[model samples]
Target: MASSRPKNAPFLFPTFNSSVLPDPSRFFSHDLLSAPLPTNSFFQNFTLKNGDQAEYFHPYIIKSSESSISISYPSLSHNSAFIYEAFNADITISGSDEPDQHSRKTHLISSFSDLGVTLDFPSSNLRFFLVRGSPFVTCSVSSGNSSIKISTIHAVLSFTGNSSSTKYTAKLNNNQTWLIYASSPINLVNDGGSSINCGGGFSGIIRIAVLPDSNPDFESILDRFSCCYPISGDADFTKPFALEYKWEK
Candidate 1:
């Protein structure tokens, strides 16, 4: 499928370049690239000493930073915000068909809380994006205290075929806030499904605003960006998150 590009700045998606990307099939994964990116391309990437890597992406740009893995790209607009919340679900016990079979899913999300960044904006003209061209499913680890901490440090998408959309709601006095509805959503490669072998590695970057909300009902950006995840339910991780609001407007 062709990448449906974003507009410069519109009511819904008004904070990015409007160039349409070539068919996703035409884009090659980094594992296949044998050398540096073309001088004029829009894709950019950085790999850390410990092998941690993320990409700096424009509509047509691609890059590979093999030595600098810790740097991050800040928001480009005054009304931008960036947020990342993830939980590493580890299994303490495997489920078996036997009567005594046991299984337990423990949330490892909070254990690595210090790995994320929270940027604040004064007003609500927010635009957010998950940058790297694709989502992650498998990554080889060499840094962090142990080898299993690869995706844990970067908030890489869950490899278990789980897609989650979260809604955050709050209540406020009489006012109107449309940041959530007005913001942009980057529809990235879905579910990490193709299993293209690249040393079990993938990269992604998300963009958010830190400016003030043009509409006043929302006092702080966090109030709207915070998400609520259910502790437990007989539900698959495939949940389409709708918005939840406290109602200031």
Candidate 2:
């Protein structure tokens, strides 16, 4: 008339226990502006798993794992070219050499498990699409309403299995300025190469809307191009130009 059971036994029947899944909405399409793209700029939408969508300004999207991606539009004062940067892992480029070929194009996408960085022209605009990766540090300069500001981001995947990407804007400002997004973290230095105290950051999707500097004071700007050589074409896909970060510390 009595029944006995194991105190620590595994369940054999299907249980109603539920597990929490990651929500892409928190990180993607949270507060996007419906404002149209400016001249010489375009908007491209990407569909992630679960059918969620995110829109990016530039044509290229840098997909990576184990490392973060950085796309730079070095200021006109520094240079007139675009840069694509990645660190701590390997990646590959997808999309077309001439994305302008179509107005709204969607390539054969897959599960977000591969690592790749899409490289486009040497034009003055650069954007980054970071996949899974470790903490990456980088900075950027933005100008708004005659005010110039430099900011940094420390993007890291935390121990809680969630990602952290925070943008820290610098307090400095100017009347008219040039916006520069470094392909890598920049170390500010004096004339003698002594390091300055500019803060550090991590590489993440650059969401700042960047416009080409209409005016530049070339003389006052520090020279970071002595180590980089120019590529002839408008960034030929077969022979894409590379700009190594001169101030890696």
Candidate 3:
């Protein structure tokens, strides 16, 4: 079954060799050119699992669990020094620490199972997910051109039943404008918390994929989703940085 997924959230994805990825056009309508990142001066900030405070942040993508793993980016404005906002300028990110405020490199990455947000590591059975910091503040797609590669991503896991400490890793695809594959059913509460649905003494790996926004293949998946389930929300809006942490047993 399909669950509500944010188009821009950082999601844990698995590489599927399957030649079959349903078309996405049926499920999505908002195009990138029609909706650009917010250009307004006002900023919005949703608290993140991390203790650091922020005003305008966005988790461009969250991992696969219903738990919200936000990837936040600072807002775009002329006053912000990190970004050169003039027309025809290339996008950029920076690090700053002037004592009055806290700043770090534009990239921010954390896993729900690692943050101690929910379960204590010693008591939980979940293996940590190794990933790069999220919302790396360097991504932009020209209005006329619909394709862009933000960066390469990776994830690692060891099966729950496996006794060996060995873990498997995969590099995620960066072609799509937006995509999310949840290997399991996860619930996303309005407040950005989550619970997993692994039950009945059954535990196995699940794989999901988000095809590139430009891929003709995405249109097919979206089409099926629309016919069976209507798509809601403007696909182009940036999801605010959210609260999510995990515990395994």
User: Highest lDDT, which number?
Assistant: 2
For 1-249, candidate 3 gives per-residue lDDT tens digits of 875677887675554453543322211123422332232211211122232223322232232121112232222466545653222101111111121123221222221222111110111112223222221221111121111111222211111221221111122222223222222232211111111122222122222223333465564564343212111112222447754332232
**Segments of candidate 1 deviating more than 4 angstroms:** 1-42, 47-166, 169-249
Q: Cα RMSD to native, each candidate?
A: 21.2, 21.2, 24.3
Model 2 residue 104 CA deviation in Å: 32
TM-score against truth, every candidate: 0.18, 0.18, 0.20
| lDDT per model vs. reference | 0.21, 0.25, 0.24
- Of the candidates shown, which would achieve the greatest TM-score relative to the real structure? 3
Question: After best superposition, candidate 3 residue 174: deviation in angstroms?
Answer: 19
Q: Write the per-residue lDDT of candidate 2 for residues 178-240, one digit (tens) a residue.
A: 222333343322122211122342232232222224233441231233122211112223444
Model 3 scores worst on lDDT over the 10 consecutive residues at: 88-97
- Model 1 lDDT tens row, 1-249: 854666663334344432553222122333434433232222212112221223343211211111111222222433346554222111111111121123111111110011111111111111112232211111112222111111111222322211331111111121211111111122222224311111321122222221233344443543344332111112233547743222110
